[model samples]
Target: MIKKFLLTMCLLAALAVGGFLYVKQSVTDFIAQPLKIEQPHLVTVERGNNLNTIISKFVDDQWINPTQFSTLVRRFHPNLTQIKVGTFEVLPGMTFEQALNTIINGKEYQLAITFIEGSTFKEWREQFKQAEYLEHETDGLTEAEIARQLGIEHDKLEGLFLAETYHYSVGDSDLDILKRAHRKLDVILEQSWASRQDKLPLKNSYEALILASIIEKETSVPSERERVAAVFVNRLNKRMRLQTDPTVIYGMGDRYDGNIRKKDLREATPYNTYVIDGLPPTPIAMPGKASILAAMNPENSNYLYFVASGTGGHVFSKNLRDHNRAVQQYLRQLRSKK
Candidate 1:
């Protein structure tokens, strides 16, 4: 009777050992096998999704063998029932283990969009419209309604969103991106406004933003920003017409045929700083951080006029007579080039 009992125990132990060895080999083989994907596959694990759902999704997509994958997960990572919510990219020829690890680690597949400085709000909207991954919530909303939706109380929406490259996951809302940029602008505007010099003609931070946008449109050179800002500041202090061609072009709208004519300047519009006093109603384009800083801290200069120096920068002057001379020089340079 003792021999029979010992024999039974040995047989049971052998079966257990055989089962363990088989499972170990199966797990190893499953993990080592590459996923069947010709192109990169995107797997989105939403919140509240379980391992079963993930496995089913992969199986349905034919990314993995359902039976083998289930066995491997059950034996190796039984506690990994829920994957973190994110979109993971499973590249072609990656091993099953590699793809699974990427999903488990929640490495999101990020998309990027850039808003260029000096680009108008219209251009910004066009970019948002073209972004494939962004969910368009504010597409049909009016500009004012869009501002309200973004939690901004401003009457104007132009130059409100900061220019920067923003990263987002798939299915992220465009409104969310706009909100982030707006908040960034708010933070930067406040910090810059707090550090501004005393007794400036600007009424508020928004006015500074407007000036910054003008400066941004004026020049791309880093060294020229403060000088150009100083020109505008000097003009504002003297209650002189900004007479900036950019403002005139902005006011001319469809009438501006790639050139600023005498009529365009003479035509009265709210945006035409030549006709209206002080800053325009709103910013004409998005301003970068450098422009914003330059607007707040303009160089101490008596200069009131600027014309393109033909070297991708501007030449500033203290009076209209000098400005006219600089303009003549600019014309001579243009004629020479032609």
Candidate 2:
């Protein structure tokens, strides 16, 4: 009688162990099952979302038991309960476990905005106006008002922001992007000024920024940055008017209709370098790092003038006679093309 009772208890114990093993294997297989996404899909987890909310989506889509998924999450993957708040891209054929890992790891999708070198702050604002998913907090605000908010001392906000690609998440404001760019510009300008070449004729970093903006507008060719810098530097050293056309155009504001006449150059404005004795009152545009560095450390040259070459570059000249020849050559190229 005792031997029969012991055998009966042992058989029941064996059946219970087998049933537990079977349930564990079934849950593991369910977690490893591939998602039904035919293509890539974006999943956004907003604030106040938890494991239940996330799993509810999968449960609705896959016809899976929500209780089962929730029990597994609580038992094995408790980290999924605290997922990140951002947009996530889930690819096809990814398992539920893998997708949960992606959300928990928090590598959110990022969008980018690019500012062209030598582009004006107004152009940057226009880009922000057109960018998708970015909050336009700076929209309809004047430059002076925006400058005050940015803590800039003056209303002259040109060249204060750096030109580069800035990444942001959804719900980020345009002002947020500008803040980051401004901080980066400050660090770069401080570093460049600390290691600048001697006798650059720039009294301060702001002056360097102004000169850099001029250099940026002067040439699109990378090699010609130093050349353009030298021309402006030599003019500054000689106490001569910079006589740059872009400065004139900037001073003209919306009155500038593409063509710059002699009358425009002679017009007296704070930004008109032709009419001003030294650098402009403010930078003309947002200059890149190369132009900023060139302004701080110009090459040793006596180049006082430059004219656009026919082949998308500039011809530098030290004397007025040579500069006139290059100008004539540029006009001839334009006429020949016509």
The best candidate in terms of lDDT:
2
lDDT of 1 by residue, 1-338 (tens): 99999999999999999997888777677667788889987888888887778777877888876565364666576655547788888899898777877888756999999999998877888999999778999888888889888878876698998999999999999999998999999999999999998888899999999999999998999999999999999889988988887888877776768988777788889999878999999999899999999999999999999999998888889988999999999999999998
Candidate 2 per-residue lDDT, tens place, 128-176, comes to 9999779999988999999888888879789999999999988899989
Pairs that collide, model 1: none
Model 1, poorest ten-residue lDDT window?
Answer: 66-75
Clashes of each: 0, 0
| TM-scores, one per candidate | 0.91, 0.84
Residue 310 in candidate 1, Cα distance off native in Å? 1.1
Model 1 error, position 132 (Å)? 2.9
Q: Over 4 Å off in model 2, which ranges?
A: 1-30, 59-73, 76-82
